[model samples]
Target: MNDSGAVLPWLVIRQDDNGNRYRVGRYATRAEAQKMADSLDARGHKQLYWVERIGQSVQ
Candidate 1:
């Protein structure tokens, strides 16, 4: 499953440190997305963000 957003909903998570940490995942709800990201046990510089389709993808 791609888990890509269909409606283009999103949640943005950010980390500080050379600006090199981020992740994206599709979610039915913002709460669900936040839970999923929290479940990752992010440490050091691992930031998870639930961002929907803002632009367009070729593939």
Candidate 2:
């Protein structure tokens, strides 16, 4: 959460070759989440990574 007391909206998700999906992390902004996904992708692995907005925030 940021100063606004709201849950972070951005998420970094990873999908492995086995099709298992995992939540890497959450960020306050999409850019931050995308950057993390890109950095992980640069590692040259079979796993796939991307960013998305949270469908629903934590109460």
Candidate 3:
């Protein structure tokens, strides 16, 4: 649990395309996304939206 006693990740994701999509995960920090992007398993680009969590955690 975090300081607020909520099970939430450190950062979220957002796709930087025409759609401007978004996603959330239980990551420990924003750097984790960087690491995931650096070592991505996909063939395309690692474009993702990142944001700090607020309020209650989402699934």
Candidate 4:
């Protein structure tokens, strides 16, 4: 949950070429989003991939 109290799953993704990060989409749970991220990595959709909870700050 966030300050707004909205409940949803979220994940972070980045493009391999440009190193730009963006939100993949909302899912039912964190695990599902992580699975998607892993799938992307496995399939070579993205060279650099990451998955994290919504509202989380990445450094």
- Alpha-carbon lDDT of model 1: 0.49
RMSD of each: 6.7, 4.7, 6.2, 3.7
Clashing pairs in 2: none
Per-candidate TM vs. native? 0.41, 0.81, 0.37, 0.65
Single out the weakest 10-residue window by summed lDDT for candidate 3: 34-43
Displacement of the residue 24 alpha carbon in candidate 2, Å: 0.2
After superposition of all CA atoms, the RMSD between model 3 and the true structure is 6.2
Clashing residue pairs found in predicted model 4: none
Model 3 lDDT, residue 45, Cα: 64
CA lDDT, every model vs. true structure: 0.49, 0.87, 0.55, 0.71
Residue 13 shift from truth in candidate 3, angstroms: 0.7
Q: Clashes per prediction?
A: 1, 0, 2, 0
Q: In candidate 2, what are the lDDT values of residues 1-59, reduced to their tens digit? A: 76779778899988888888899998989989999999999999989898888895322
> Tens-digit lDDT track for model 4 on 1-59?
66678777676566557766667666657788888878778885537777777677578
Residue lDDT tens for model 3, 3-59: 778655555555665756566455665577555544542446656444555454434
Better by TM-score, candidate 2 or 1 = 2
Best model per TM-score: 2
What does the lDDT read for residue 14 in candidate 2?
89
Poorest 10 consecutive residues by lDDT, candidate 1:
50-59
